[model samples]
Each structure stands twice: as C-alpha cells, then as structure tokens.
Target: MIWPLDGASSDVVFNTWSHFSLSLNLEAASFTRYITPTKVEQKVRHLVIEWIRNEIVRHIPDAEVLVFGSTPVDMYLPSGDIDLVVQSKSLAVEGPPRSNITRIADILRSTDMALGEVRIFASAKIPILKFVSRHGKFSIDISVNVSNGVAAASIIRDFIRDIPGVKPLSLIVKCFLRSRDANEVYRGGLSSYLVVCMVIYFFQTHKGMRKSHTDPSSSLGNLLLEFLQLFGYDFNYLQSGISLRDGGKTFSRSERHWIYRPSQPRLCIEDPQNTQLDAGAGIHDIRRIQMLFIHAYDQLQAEIQRRDRSRSKALLLEGNSLLQIIMGVPLNVSATGPRWIAIDKANARKSSIGSILPCSIPQGDSIDY
Candidate 1:
C-alpha cells in the first residue's frame, strides 16, 4: 500500500535549477536518498516493454503480467537485465503450464524484425523472462513457478526491509564463501555454486536425510535417487580441447560416490531449464566450490557474531533480508495514513517490468552439457 501524492504538500522543493539538471535527489530523514540521473536508460526500457506487450497481444490477448525485477526501486544497475513475466492466451496453463521460453522464442523470431533479439516467456504460474540489452545481446529466458505465490513473496520481501543490520551480514557471508571456495578447491568445502547445496544439505542434515521439495516420507526413495542424479556429472566429455559431447543420459553408481578432487575455475554452466539441479559437471566441481564457501561462511558467521554483540543469538537466520526486500516489492509504497494505495498495474501493451539481474543464460551453449 503506497501513500498518495498531493500537489499542495508542504514538503516541496522549489529550485528552478533542478528543472534543468540531469539528476534529482529524493530525500527522507529516515532513509538514504536514492539518486537517479535524468538519462535515457529508463525511457528506453519503457519503450521496449511496450513493444514486448504489443508483440504478445499480437498472438495472445488475455494475460496478466507481474514484474519482479531491479527496476522499480531504482536498483537497475548498468549491468542489469530487463526481466519480465507473461500470461498470454497463446500459452496453455492447464497441464504442466506451457513452455514460456518456447513461445517467447517464437515471438522473437518474428518480433526481432522490430525490436531485435527480444526475449519472451510463458507461464502457468510464475513465468520469468529476463534479457540483457547491452552490446546488442538482448535475450529473454523464461521459467514458470507458483503463480499464486506472488503475494507470499511480497510479504517476505517487506518483512526483511523493516529490519535493520541485515544487508551487511549477507554480503559479507557471500563474499567469504566465494573466496574460501576458490582457495580450497578440492579439500575444502565452501563456495558460491554450493550455496544451494549448503541450504539443502542443512535441511537434510538436520533431519539426517534428504526429502523432495514435495512430501517427505511419501517418496523418500524417489527423492534420494533424484538428489544423487543431480550431482552425477557428465563423464562423457573427458577434458578435451573443443571436442563436442553431451551430458550423460543416465546416472551411474560411480557418480554418486566422491573421490579425491581439485578446485579451480568453477565448471558450473548455466542450466536454462531451471530444474535447479547440479548438472553437466562432476563431484569435483561441487567439492571445489563447497571447500571455499565453507571458509567464507565461517568468516561471515564470525563477522555477524562481532556485530551481534548487540544482535540476536538465533541459531540460524534468513540473512537475505535486504535483497529480499527490494526483490519482493513489485511497486513502491510510502506511509501517509489511509490514502496509500499501490495499484496493481495491468500488463498493458505499453507497461510491464522484469527482474534486474541478467542471470538466465542461453538455453544451449554447452557442447558436452
């Protein structure tokens, strides 16, 4: 819920020079003022968004769009991507929810004549389409999750923003993990790639076992088998120079077992399908990253403890509080009593938003993957 703006508010700036300046400062005593330059970046993005919507409606008309990205709160860094979500009539939402990526790709084939390399996605739930416009490499990668989970995500983001002293801790932890994992390589256990592994490992270790994202006891066998399948690497490609290969179609017994390993450049490649599995690489890759992250994670804990001399003793915390806050809010809100109302913008032909980071990679860039 955002507060409304009144024209006659006493808190107003009357500097005529500001009208001619290339940037403006938003001030609030309780918060840091975010400065945005009067530049063409946002204008360009808004135009692209329009082209995207019209292109979608050219095929399918009845769809709702919810954008979660780095734009709204002005976190759109120069390196960020244009992220978006689409619910169009061309997509089938009944079964597994139609492939948003495929539809977007098809649209790109035709729409590229106008926008050039536009990215699109289809979703039965939460479909994300992210693209980079820099260096003329604009592309869209889409994925579908729980469509109904939008509100829950918002609540989670807002909860974190209300709290203080959370942001610095998370950055410290992530940096520590990245450095430690890089240094240890094989023998150590800490890393950026292994973060998910750490969390999943945490969940399982606390319970002494792994469970599917779904029911636990209902399919224990299936879950462990799937988990093992994830870590098993594609041994088909044996470190050759530019030799073409593909990921193993089957999971073998040896892959489930870890041998001595080494850590170097992270072997992890982009998995566009978002199956959220560790694919293509070997146990060596995970172990290497894990080794480093362990050291960083430990350092993060020490730093947090240092700060927590005035902080809490919670055994664990969802330290991703600040980033989560900006990520969660689809629109902004200001407190001004009951007049605040943040309108859910309909996905029109001229308006929509997407995620800020260009993390989603191309679908098929790996030779042996």
Candidate 2:
C-alpha cells in the first residue's frame, strides 16, 4: 500500500537550489571524472553483480547472460541503479519476476551482506528483476529480453560514450529543459526529450553560437521533431496544464495559470533571443481580436445610423454580440462595438459626467451585457 506522505517535508529554502558547489578546477572535460560513484554505490553494485553471476551459474548452468552497465565495469549509468540485461532466446519473456524476490531474500538471509529486502515482480512491460536493499531502501533493476534486429542499448551507449563532450552537453541541456518546464508549468505535459529538441532547433538556426556547440546532444532535438511530425500535437498546448500523481495516489487534475506573462524569462537556457521572440508571438494573438472588433463596429455603426428610430436599435445590438463576448472585451471597445446616438462616452470619463454607456457605436449593444 502507498503511504500518505504527500507534503510531509517542510518547504525547501529558495537559496537551497542555488547552493551547488563551485569548483574553479572544473572543466567540461572534468564532468566525466566528477561523476565518480560513491563508496555505497560501489558496494551495492559489486554485491548485485556477484550474486547475479553466481545465480545464473547455479540455477541455469551453461546459459550465458549478457551483463553490462555498472556490473561488467564502472560505467556511468544515469539511472544510478545497477542495470543487468539478460538475454532470453528461450524460456518466457517476463516483467520483474516475483520468484526472484523469494530467491534474493533467501540468498541475502544466509549472507552477512549489508543489502536487504529484495523484491522481484514480473510484468510484461518492464524489468524482470528488482532488488531492494535495507540501507536507504536502495534498489537495482534488471531487464531480460530477446535480441531484436537492433540492439538499441549498444547503439545509444556507444554514441554517447564515443562522442566527445556528448554526456556533459546532454546533462546541461537536460537540466535546463527540466528547469524550464517546471517554472513554465509546475508539471510538464511534453516529455523531456521534446523540450530538448525544441531548444536545439532554436539554437541550430540561432547563428551566433560558438565553435564548441558541436555535441551529439543535438540529435535529441532531431528525434523530438520526428516524434512531433509523426504524432501531431499542438506544441503550445504543452504550456496549458499538467497533472501528476502524488504519494502514489491519483486525483482529478487541476490547473493554475500564470496571471502575467514574463517579459523576459530567465529559465530558458537555450537561445535567449528566441525565447523573447516567442513571447511576443504569444501576445500578438490579441491583434486578431482588434481587427474583428473594428470590422464589427464599422458595420454596426452604419446600420444604427441608417435606422433613425432608437426604439428598435437595442434588438440589433443583441443579435451580433457574439464577437465581443467571446473576446471578453466590450463591443464598443471593439471595432464592431455599438454606439448610442445620444450617449457621449468621451464625457462619461469625467467625475460628474455622461451616461455609463460608451460612445463607440450602436447604442443597443450595452443592453446585451
């Protein structure tokens, strides 16, 4: 069962996020070395690796299991969890295995090892093996799958590792994209991959980049474009609203809008100029409402002037009030706005002045509201 620990922690200080250690010696080249695994990490990884190697030998002798990630060597797997991929040419394709939980529990019980409380679940979609440790309740996930036509793991792993500066570039871009999404909307509707792609495209055509901006991380931007074209979804819709599961519990989604648009967003780390350009674009949609209002007012004003009788003017205003109401601004404020023949709106702004009705056009439009 899921625990009710939502909002249990106190609010983190605003400065806490900004307090990352600054090392003058750090270079983009040094990022690879900076990510050295901790001691606990080393112990947990070695323990899992040894147990798996032994288990495969004992349980299914002569069967070779493909071992990679942290186990085979000190590879920097971002998941931080020890990932072991097992080849399955025969037997059953499975998710995390429940029996592996019992097997792990039995193994840990006899040994004086620090690791504890192993759990395995077999579902069709995810890793076939999962191990849980008592210390910090740390866990490692292992997936077992048959070799498809393409070994996607090797392809991605090789590309990042072999390419110069790819990992650092990717890490920087990932952090920036995630931060932008969080500040833009507390939860993100678009995937991180999509955000990365958008930023890359903005920079690729940006023209003012330094020579160092040549990492393979730009490929993610390409992947994102392909995905968007293949699956048509409005990019702007991602800014609308997002929902998240809290404390492993579900609830109906809710939204909070930013009442004011940012003049210049500091969170966008891609092309600073492009972000400013887009903000103007988002605000310019109001110009359409301007034109719609003007056209409506011109036509409505002429119609009212043609009909000298004021008694039936109110009926005409009510009939064509849709454009103003939809735009949430008064019709007289718009081009198609009504003007009262007798009401002088210019004098209405005075402290002790004219009628409450604005004098833009057809006098009857005010009654529709």
Candidate 3:
C-alpha cells in the first residue's frame, strides 16, 4: 500500500503523491510552530533551573549543576522533562553518597519549589533524584557525575545544526512515539537519542535521497513516507544493525556481536562514539513499534487514495488529516500556538497574581479525524 497499484497510470500516481506531499509539508510546519516554546516559557524554565541549582549548591557547596538533554538544543517537546547532572570533586567515584541524595530529596520536599513528593532511585545504575518544579511544572531528573549525557547532548546539537530536516523530523517522530507510550527507554521504547540516531541514519543511507538534487527539507512528506516504508517493511532487524559513524553504515548484527537473544529479535543501533555499546539495546518491544509504523503508513496511503478518488482540491489544500492522525494531534487543534497557552489563561484567572506558567497538554488524547 506504500506505492500505487500496478494498474494505476504514471500521471495519476504522480498527482496523488504530489498532493499528499504538499499536505504533509504544511502539516509539519504548522505542528512545529505550535509546539515550539514561547519566550515567556523559556524565561520560566531558566528561573526553575536557577532555583534548583542554588538549592543543590547550598547543601553541597562544591556541587555544580549542569543542564543537559533536549532543552539546550531546543528540540524538546512541550511535555519534555528537564535533565540535570550534578558534578562535584568531593563525590565518590561510583556516585554521590546515598545520604547526600536522600538529604537532597528531603531539602526539596521542605521547599516550595518542589511540586510533589521527590523520588530518589538510589539503586539504579545511575542513581537519580526525580521531582517536578512548582514554578514551570517541569519534571526534573537529576543524576550525579553522568558526563556521558552531557556529551551526547552536544553531539545531537551539532547534528541538528548541520542537518536541515533533523529538528522538525525529530520533533514529529518524538511526538509519534510518545503518544503510543513507546518513547521511554525504561519502558522498553526508544529514547530521544536513539530516535535521533535512527533519523540521521535514514537520511544518510537513503539511496534516492542522496542522489536527488532536491533538498530533503522541501520534500519531507515523501521522505516521511519512505522512512516509514524503510523501517516498517524493508528493514532487516534480525541481521542488520544501524550505525552513524563514518557518515553512516549498516553492519551485520552477528559480526558486531550486537545480536539479542534468539527468542527476541530487537533493533540494534551502534553508538557513534562507542563501538562497544548498542544504543537501541533497551528496546524490547521493537516488533510492536515496527508494526505501528506499518499501520500508520497504510493509513496515510489510504487517506491519499480517498482524496484522489474524490478529486477534491479543497480537501488537499485545507490540511492533512492522516498526518494529524498519526501524530495524535487533533484536527481541531489550532496551528497558531500550543494548547497550553489557553490553559495558562485559565490558571491566571484563578491565581491571586496574574501570572502565566507553562503547562503540558496530556498526550494520547483520542483523535476524531
């Protein structure tokens, strides 16, 4: 269903694809603009960061708090959590002392800054203190001496700067995976870093894309279709592994010893910086995720065919219903700005001081397109 039927004329096929492509391009633009953080939201985030930094430094004098993950690169979604790494020379080589983490949690709970009960997972591979900021309502995950996360953020930032379509495409893909509860690594879904690597690899290895003179940014609709087709139907998960090193490469999973247990055939993606590590090793439900991509592609193709049969230029120009459906964005959602802005307005009316704070719209809302 990814391509036109054999009996379809060339002109008809071209027209159908062209119309769908244009619709997708418009949808992607509108969605990006709507989800992008406003200036006021950015200020609130800064204030939250500073408040947390001061609190941590007050208790642990030598501790230096650093921001990492999506916030620095401006690629985060509206509902994204904040990632902070606390580093100090006084801390043990293994990690911060358990007493320090517990003390930090206690201090946060006693303060007005922490919105809810602070949870500390001291036994985790990388122990972390998790809490929500009362100021911006942003979820914060704090880890000690995790330098690798900081390095990964810098690398992803460079990729976004050099690649034309990475930002928008990544945002869309993140939203898609998040809606299905398949974007959290701990929950057996791909992490944001893994998702970005997949996208970069797709751009690098696509044969038609490399040869075409047209800029990939201009043809995101077609590129999205092809991306889904490649990963959903064509990718050989059992044998092949994705790599972004040396521009991009596909290697045999067995050769690299990246293969999972025989009972579980999962996706393998080698960390560009660390050959020994497989970034996608955590994705245990990759098969279901792949099938979701296939279903989304089929749904989009069906919508295109339906429009083609109707011969409705108005439908094509108005918006892309299938794209919205796949992204879990409601057809009625405004393209002018995020839905949180309206929620903030309501919150401002209820508060004694007329102040607006950023809020997250719950994802996975049913789409009635």
Candidate 4:
C-alpha cells in the first residue's frame, strides 16, 4: 500500500518545495554547475538542426527533420544534448545505414558548425551522428528515422499542457539526476525520458493527494517527496514491473517472461507504445540509485522534524537548506584520469574528437517540432 501524506508531513513538503523552487533561481544557481538552457542556447540548437536537415535533403529530396526530447518540450538543461531524427525514403537501402550516415556526417564536418569531432556510430543498434557545437557548447545526436522519439515528444508535450507544475517538477528532478550523475541510462543509470514517464504515472494515479482546485506548484512539493518515496521504498522491481499505460498497475514478472540475468540490473518500466522494450533496461546500478533516493527522503524528514521542534540548527539551515542538499554543495569537476582509458595495451585508444569533413547548406530546412 502507498503511504499517505498526512496534514503535518504535507505542510513540511509544501514549505520545503517553496524554498527549493526559490533557491533554484537564487542560491542553487551559484553552486550548481548547470542551468536550464538559456534562450541563446536554444536558438543555437535550432540553427544547427536546420543546417543538418538541409544538407541531408540535398541527396534525399523527400527527407524530413524532426527535433524531439527535452529541448522541444522545454524541459532541458543548458548542458542537455539535442536529439534529432532524420527520415527519408532514400535511407531504406540494400546495406548497413552507416555508410550513408557517414556520408552525411562528412558533409556536416565541412561546415563551421562542426567545431568538435563528429562521430558516426555505424554499429550502434540505432546508427547515430554525434557532435559537440563550438559556439553553442551543447552536444547533438542525430538518428536515422526514429519516428518513435517523435511520437514520444508529442505525448510528453500534451502531458505538460494538461498538467500544471509538470515542467517545473521535471526541471527540478532532472537537475537532481544530473547532479548525481545518474541521468544517462547508458552509464548504468536512468534516462530523462524514463524519469518523465515515471512522474506522469505518479501524477495520474495519486488523485487523492491532488486537489483539482489546488495549484500545481502547491501540489508539486508533496508530489516530489512522494516521488522519491515511491521509487525508494514502495516499488518492487524483483516481483513486479511498472506499466504506466495500465493505470500504473503492477504485472507479475512471470507474465513478462523477462530472462533473469544476475549480472544485469533489472527494473522494468513498460513502454506505453511498446511492451517488449524495457524503458529502464539500461539501469545497471539500481541499488545505488535507490540509495540516493532514500537518502534524499530521509534528509528531508530529518529537517522537517527539526523544524517542528523549532531547533536552532533548523534556523541555520533555512533558505536553501533543502535545495543545497538536493543539488549538492560543490559540483564534482574532477579530472583524475583521462576521459576514456583502457586497462590493457591491446585495448588502448586515444581521443577522437576533432575529425571533420566539408558539409554546408545554402538554406535552413523546415522544422516539424
């Protein structure tokens, strides 16, 4: 059973949220390394996306370019990468798609936009073109015809439109995940997409705790606290898998027939569009992730207890107390080792970041999103 937030705990959560949101605009900005992508950063992404699309269409006339993910949805951090999908009838060919994508990457390299090395992952499950912009200070990922990502962006956009506070709550949690170095699922953590889905599931199912008349900001404080509690204490990954489309219900692990691997981290979040795809399949260190969630929860509870007693220490910890703990005091900027190093001589590889080719466009491509 879910733990209900009583009146007292509810007050504490609300007050803490107020302080947390305020601090995000104030004190948290001072110590936190990242910020919500500024207007200038967003404009730079638009220009880059246009440049890529035009170059692709020169070869494939029917090609279309779509920008999805957090950027289009208005929930991205300044450091967040722009996700793009290029689709055209020309890409459906006889051999691997990498050859064609590499050609496109070559074209992009010729342009001034390709400040850093442009990489082509031909062997990736979904072939991708990755590069960091010199002027924009943001990274980009271009995939071939990933219509699913476009669909996801549409659904999330609707969710934000209907649900108040969804944007702010998402920003806060994403910042928290970024701070903990747990947002990239490929690195044994969760993705921003999965986190967004989890927040939606919680909002849909917990009507008792949400008053229709109450502003979303007020509800968000308690919702944030409950979110950590849900993942940290209540959820059972071993026995069940989360199915948001099924009204946030749990289905037995046996029903899913997922092969158990002692070596792999297993926390299943059924993709609403595709049941076979475990949205959380990339999570390899779930225990460590849950520990952080629980710690955050306990820290808030302790602070609330202190506040109730009118303690001197509680007064000292006011203003940005919760925000500081959530975002952490000092950013972790360590370069103790090379960015990527191999253990053995045979596996050794050097940085491949600045390679480029000549790809330019006369005009910008039409954008769908």
Model 3: lowest-lDDT 10 consecutive positions: 1-10
Candidate 4 lDDT tens digits, 1-369: 001111111112223333333322333222222234444445555665666667767767877878888979867765678898877667656345787677668767876667779999888888998997654545888887668988888888887787655676677677677778888877766788888887777776677634575665644556667888988888776767777774567677767876376444367778876888777776767888888889877876666565555644445333324444565542221211111110111111111211221244233333456
lDDT of 3 at 7: 21
TM-score of each: 0.34, 0.36, 0.82, 0.76
lDDT of 3 by residue, 1-369 (tens): 111112222112223445665666555554555455655455556556767777778777888888888877777776678898888876654345575677667767877777878999999877789987776677899887778888888888888776767777777788778777788988877788888888888878878766776656566766778878888998888889998887788898898877668756678988866778988887888898898789878877787777767867666455335566675556545432233433432332233211422222122222110
Per-residue lDDT of model 2, residues 87-181, tens digit only: 54332433234444344345445543235544555543443555653332335555554442024234334444544333444443333233223
Which candidate ranks first by lDDT, i.e. highest? Answer: 3
For candidate 1, the per-residue lDDT at 102 reads 59
- In candidate 3, clashing pairs total 0
Decoy 4 TM-score against native: 0.76
**Candidate 2, superposed: residue stretches over 4 Å from native:** 1-32, 36-48, 67-79, 88-90, 93-114, 133-138, 146-150, 172-369
Error of 3 at 141 (Å): 0.4
TM-score of 1: 0.34
User: Cα lDDT of all candidates, in order?
Assistant: 0.32, 0.33, 0.69, 0.62
User: Which candidate do you rate higher for TM-score, 2 or 4?
Assistant: 4
Which ranges in model 1 have alpha carbons more than 4 Å from their true place?
1-47, 69-78, 93-100, 113-131, 134-139, 144-153, 167-290, 294-369
Q: Global CA lDDT of candidate 4, please?
A: 0.62
